[model samples]
Target: MTLAPQPYLNTRVSAMSERLLTSDQIAALCELSLPDLAERFGLEALLDEQLDRRTKSRAVKQALINTLLDELRVLIRPMNATEAGLVLAWGRKYALFNLKTLLRGQLYELDQSEISANLYELPAHVRLPQQELFRAEGVLELLRKLEQGPYSLIARQGREVFEQKREPFALEAALDQRYYGEMVRRLLQVSNQDGNELKQLLGAVLDRVGLLWLLRFRFSYGLSPSETYYQLVPSVRLLHRDRLLRLVNLETFDEILAALPEPLTSRLAGSTSLMEVQRRLGGHVTDEARRTLANGQSGVARALAYLILREHGVLALFSIVQGQLLGLPRELIEIAVEVSEPNCPADSLADAA
Candidate 1:
């Protein structure tokens, strides 16, 4: 798809970037205690109104997510169809989550209202037929109904996995695989500098996801090499097909790590836990995105960078809130959120504030 003139797009992107939450804002949010957070945001009474703490917590979280989606809608509204579609594709992760929720709700025969409450209020153009999906009598019925929408292919594959193994993990993995594959395909069709940069960013993300999934399925889930490989998002630069096959066949996590190419191997060195691996890989992506935002020649890259940073801000907030809900120590919560930042050092949170 042809992008509108770059100069105009770049100016718009710059304005949008300026409007994103500043690092200081994120740090301040991270440092707030539960009471402080509720008081500052005027969320305390609304939270207290909920009968259950879990429900209250979900309400708060959904409020934040809705705010983010609103910002996203504003960003996309002025763009041409192709440009908007490209940007909106990043938000499709939420749609995928909603679809998964529908499948699970159907599987368990959950109440329609209950499922609807859990679903994010996506933009109209990007929304699924949630009412119909919620009303589906069972998993098969859900997939059949989904065939009428944009998610038909994924729904079909998910149904196959469900029917074959009848396992939630396998079905979820199938859905993830389909989503990332389609994401890459869509990004590649753009055929411009911005598209190429965005694809590179996504490629790094997909690689991290593929590696993490491989490790989890192989060790944590005890899935066979073949089963684990089947669930991967077809392979990317960091974990190409040959490398993935080799890593999957290995007998130990260390062996798998040893087989990886340089930089990733060095970057992930000495990581003993999956969480550590995730943080390291996430940091790599964040760093790359920052560089792209700073040096990229295309408006798409700058806009995409803002979106990435915005997402990180949301995640850090969620982590802090979850920690507070669990009654974790403030210091630990700070550490968790600080480590999640992209190119920033652990001490950078303090500096930002």
Candidate 2:
């Protein structure tokens, strides 16, 4: 059955697209430190002007999450039963992310108070408890608590890995890939004939994600090719599953770089740094989505508009926080941030970094 068009959702998304920073605003942000920027501007104040919270970095993150949820609430509040169900399906992705983050925070033994501070309140579903999550005794109990969700497999694998005393990054990556894969599947089911563009954009998103995983896995932890490929979420345009499987056989970063597609080859333009590769891939994906949205298709167009705004806010926040945490120079961080688009070529970005 065809659902009615949601003009309100479209309008909110359009408004959000309008408020995103331009090249000039981004350039200006490049110069400010996190605290300095927080004091100088009220992020939500400039947009909704409804939030009364102080304009700190954490506040900005909270405000972004809240604003998105507020839009979702407004869109769904008037939805009929059937439409509301569809909306709920979309909203579950964010809820799943928060749930997994909570569980991982528990596994890592982060302080309960700190974990509570990190909770992203959602528009639906009761939140998992930070205290229970952190004190869950072991991974088994953690997985048991999360049995109600779709990511049970990740928690299960995490349990096995924990016994070996390895960091959970691989497990986390695998979980994300699986979740996003499933989300895409759901999207396709309801996407209608007009959703092909959205599907393509999603495919590109998966490709970028796979690229990041391959590079990070091979470089950061020095995992064997087989081990790295085993954890990869299985959809990418440029590299087949077998190629990544074979990538494990390559001995050096240069060899892996050589094996990447032409579009991703630019990732090798500068330094061979894995972190820089991540930043570049992010920028590349955002830029591609921005371009795709400009082409003006159907639901895809609106999704692209909101997705880009969401990603920009997130990437900007990550740059600010990571820079602040590492005490890196603002100049270096900005350079890294600039390459966050998917096409910028990781090599050049790394060289600049």
Candidate 3:
């Protein structure tokens, strides 16, 4: 189904985009103490009613995420089903996150309450079967339950990967591959200008994800070329199947970087560490989203651009809160909050929360 541009929705998204937090504002907020932060951000009521000061970082982060989701829900509420579907497609990432959490928690035998506590309370229309997932006895049982749901394909793939390797990384990687693949497939079904713009944005995202996965799997996880290739999302922009095969076969990170396409090579220059690579890629994505929001004609594209910015803002805040909770230096906190880096290590502030 084609999702035509809705002028009213586009205008509303543009207005909402204007209200998003600036990097400087986020930086300044990061410097404040919990009470000061609440007062400064006008979140005192939310803080007092929903969050404990002792675990302020997690509480504040979740509250911000919920606020973002609520805003997106309102923005899309007036649109027709097809237009709403286009916007909600982006939010599927959150559903995937919840599924991954449930699967991992089940695999590790974590308590259902603990898993549920970490899951986001998505809008009713987009919500997943959290209760059913939480009640599953094991990963196999969870997969069995999900096989007939929206996440059926991913569940099946994750189950296959788990059976083959019994490794969480492989399972998670498979889920990610499935998520991006489905995103691209769905975008292709929309034959319109907005669809093309969104495809470009998603293409860049896929490239970044592929590069990061390649580096981590080869260098960090010590996976072989074949194994690394197995984890990658099939052919996107910069790293198409041929290039990916070539890069995976490369011996060192330097060689792999050298083999990259022009824009990425230039963008990633001097990114000596994994964190640096992630930081640069995050900057690229942020810039792309802003460009789309400014120039995009389609309502879905503009709304998606706003959603990207909003999600990044929330993530930046999360990083700042994490740094603060960990008693990190202000300079370090600023660096962490400057970009929207995802899949942070388990020891990060967000994880602890």
Candidate 4:
């Protein structure tokens, strides 16, 4: 796993960490107007993006991701093939977002321009062939084209779920499940020796998303236990398969909260709302990633940790910038940045708005 010399990655990441905005710093920036914030923190790129009325939000979001991924390409240069593949799997989530958009567009028979509006201009290596895929006349055809490309497995799984359940929600869930399933495979490949390496770093993540998704799919969407269970990512220590299966049957938040195992139970005590639970869990994962980044381990774990924190930072930055540019209220601005859940593949900008 010692892919290459560690000094370069360590030094680069450590230096970049200093340059990243602290939570307090970001909070302080929220108090300033767009101009003042841009001048202060050198957010000229965001400022420039805001000037475009038509593509303001989309442009800024794409800018943040592109910058992050470009830096990732540099950081992962020293990694061995397997290590790089793991990082790429994580980074490719954005490109997959485009695939999600395509699927939804085809589902509704939306115009190509409208679909393209929501897609990100991902790094060339990760970018999907949108023009070709856009030619499909229906969701099934779109998926068929998708299967010929990098996301063949994800598309195939999505098709299976769609064919079985015949619902858009389940189709998107299947795609996410397959994506994470593939990610887990690559994660183990890099760190399966002792099963001790990324378990802690990624365990918090898997657990956090798994729990939150279980609550939402089982309750919010009212899917059956078996159906909701299929939508979740692979289980982790605290919320293993058995606990999640039982969790799916609970009738209320109180029952689910009471049934949770130790640590999670104590940590989430008195947390009645799913939002509160999500905020707490998200912060926990963020803290763990920070610790992993600072840990003196091999570059693989630290690099992964860097990407997690870096993604969080850029998103917070985007939330602040997007809110300020749009003249949204302070409360709205603050809430936008708080880590809750990842964007659902089925939701477009319109769906989010």
Candidate 5:
């Protein structure tokens, strides 16, 4: 008989969770000066800690992203093959962002140096051949090269958009749909107890993303209902396939919101705009992540939850830091941070319900 893989010893992750800021702590940090904020977070060591506002802001932002990647390295170190693969694939989302940047740079014939300056280096496993991709003669060739890589699913979707001569907006939507679809499939294949817990949190996130994207593409961008349906991530959460299809066909935002299923129907009730729904879902995801980090099994599940929440903390800090650098008022910075790191009152909702 085949032996089972050992569960991860997630002690480091549990300890690391304590390092993330509480919501109150984040709000408190918003009151600090930029220099004080950087020092409080111990971000001085990550970058040059420069004097120029623009340069310092970029360094701080890069430091935040780099910290996430460093933590990700530690988290992915002890997982079994499947679990590691899933986490590593999650990391590739960054690579896709770089891919789009590179594609646009090439398409518009932007200076190579300018494009190169914008690219981030993901770890080797997730890193595509950037130099080779950059050398490709045209957008079609870039897609062709991407098709030969591990991210062929998303690349194929991009290629189809190119072939059809769709707008850049449509191409981006197609690539995102494929990327999230593959992730949902991977999450479904993970059968461990911890996997199930992680899936509940991640599935909720996917639901939010898919619903938000559906609303934007259908109503905001004026895509037809069928076009909107085709653009959505393949979701199996609160907003599953049939639910999303029903949503796309609805004539207006209120109609779709009214038709929304259980928890969402409750959570997003009386929300005036897509932005409100997004903020409400942001809080919902934050609540689920915090609960998971506190109470879930100590393994990849908790580790991933910690990373998710940590990213939120970083975003809140990043926004405050940038706002202060720009000398924005306390009120505007608070507003931005609230939207960035929304937290809701504790409530009972069935996982994967």
Candidate 6:
């Protein structure tokens, strides 16, 4: 008989529930510079203490990225099947993102060494040296290796785009939309329970991600309706593809905001930039998770909440560290960080209904 995996995920969920940082901790974090903040709060210690390196202050930019990868892998290592699946899904997306980064970085003739340094390595893949990556022979070979994995479709699409002398942005968008769309479909199909708050929270994230992509691609990147519509990953049922297409086709951002649905519209419409909109969207999603967890949806809510909490904490740490190294003001970092972390009321109404 095959041995069963340990049930320690529940124990971990309980532990995480306790450490869900208080509002005071967030306020304190908001007040400190990257270095001082890390040292004072032991954020620096997470790097040196947890991972055993100082994560040099001046190199905080790269260090933040590396630490995040390491920390996330550590967290995911012990999770149960469902819990691990959630993390794995997000990880695959980031891996896809890194692939896009490599393609763009190489195509733009960025230094091979610098490009290699920026890549995020998953436990599955072998790392490549930066110095040799620029040479066409090595780039193709790396892509060949990556092509054998989950990214085969994207690698194929990228090749076509490369041949056509077109940017891979559209292809990237399509891959994201397809992946998330499938995920949402699978989750809903498997979950017969109508009141699953975990599904609701995940749906909210999907909708927001789609909304952000639609808004950003349409406004910032100038994607047409077909392009924007085809690239959306609808992990949630809230958004209608037709509606998204219509919004992107609108003449102005104000008009687009005016047509948005309740709560989301109100939160996102206030932002003059995509970054601001993303911040509000992320906060609302976290709030939804907290609400779900409060209403007795332990397994799913616990899973979603943990992911949100981890992402928010790690990303904030990354931002502050990067901001300080860049000499950006604390205020700027705070504003930027807000996009990823929100100050939600811990006692908000439950989402079980």
Tens digits of per-residue lDDT for model 2 on 20-132? 66556766777666556655544533233453333334566666666666655554554444444434444555665766667666667777677666667654442444455
Q: Rate the local accuracy (lDDT) of all candidates.
A: 0.73, 0.58, 0.75, 0.75, 0.77, 0.58
lDDT of 6 by residue, 1-353 (tens): 01222235435556666645544565567666545766764555434543423335424434444554554465565644554555555546556656666767755767766766666654452233323334545334545555565555545555554456555555455456655754564455433332265577777878788777777767777778777776666545567666676776787767877888887777776565565566577778877767665553344445456656656666666666666656787767776566334343322111110
Cα lDDT for residue 12, model 5? 77
In model 5, the Cα lDDT at residue 153 comes to 85
TM-score of each: 0.86, 0.71, 0.87, 0.88, 0.89, 0.73
Cα deviation of 274 in candidate 1 (Å)? Answer: 1.2
- Location of the lowest summed lDDT over 10 successive residues in candidate 3: 344-353
Candidate 6 lDDT trough over 10 residues, lowest sum: 344-353
Whose lDDT is greatest here? 5
Better of 2 and 4 by lDDT: 4
Residue 101, model 3, lDDT: 81
> Where does model 1 exceed 4 Å of error?
1-5, 19-28, 34-52, 78-80, 339-353
Candidate 1 per-residue lDDT, tens place, 1-353, comes to 24534666567667766645554676667767777877765556334754466776677777677766777776675566666666777777888889988887877778778887788777675688887776677888888888776778778888888889998877888888888787766776776676777767777777788888888888777899998998887544578788888889999878887778877899988766666677778877777777776777766666667677777877677777778887887767766776433333332112100
Which 10 successive residues of model 4 have the least lDDT summed? 344-353
Question: Over the stretch 1-353, how does candidate 3's per-residue lDDT look in tens digits?
Answer: 23456677777987788778887788677768755766765555435655454456656666786777788798777765655765676677788888888877877888777876777777665678887776777888887788886778778888888889898877888888887877767666665786788776777777888888888888877899998998887544678888999999999877888889978899988666666677678778778888888888777777778888899887876676667667787777776786234334422111100
Can you give the lDDT of residue 197 in candidate 6?
54
Candidate achieving higher TM-score, 1 or 3: 3
Candidate 5 all-Cα RMSD: 5.1
Candidate 4, residues 243-276: lDDT per residue as tens digits? 7888878888678888888767887887756776
Residue 4, candidate 6: C-alpha displacement in angstroms? 16
Off by over 4 Å in 6: 1-8, 33-36, 40-83, 125-144, 160-165, 185-189, 192-195, 269-275, 296-298, 339-353
lDDT of 2 at 166: 52
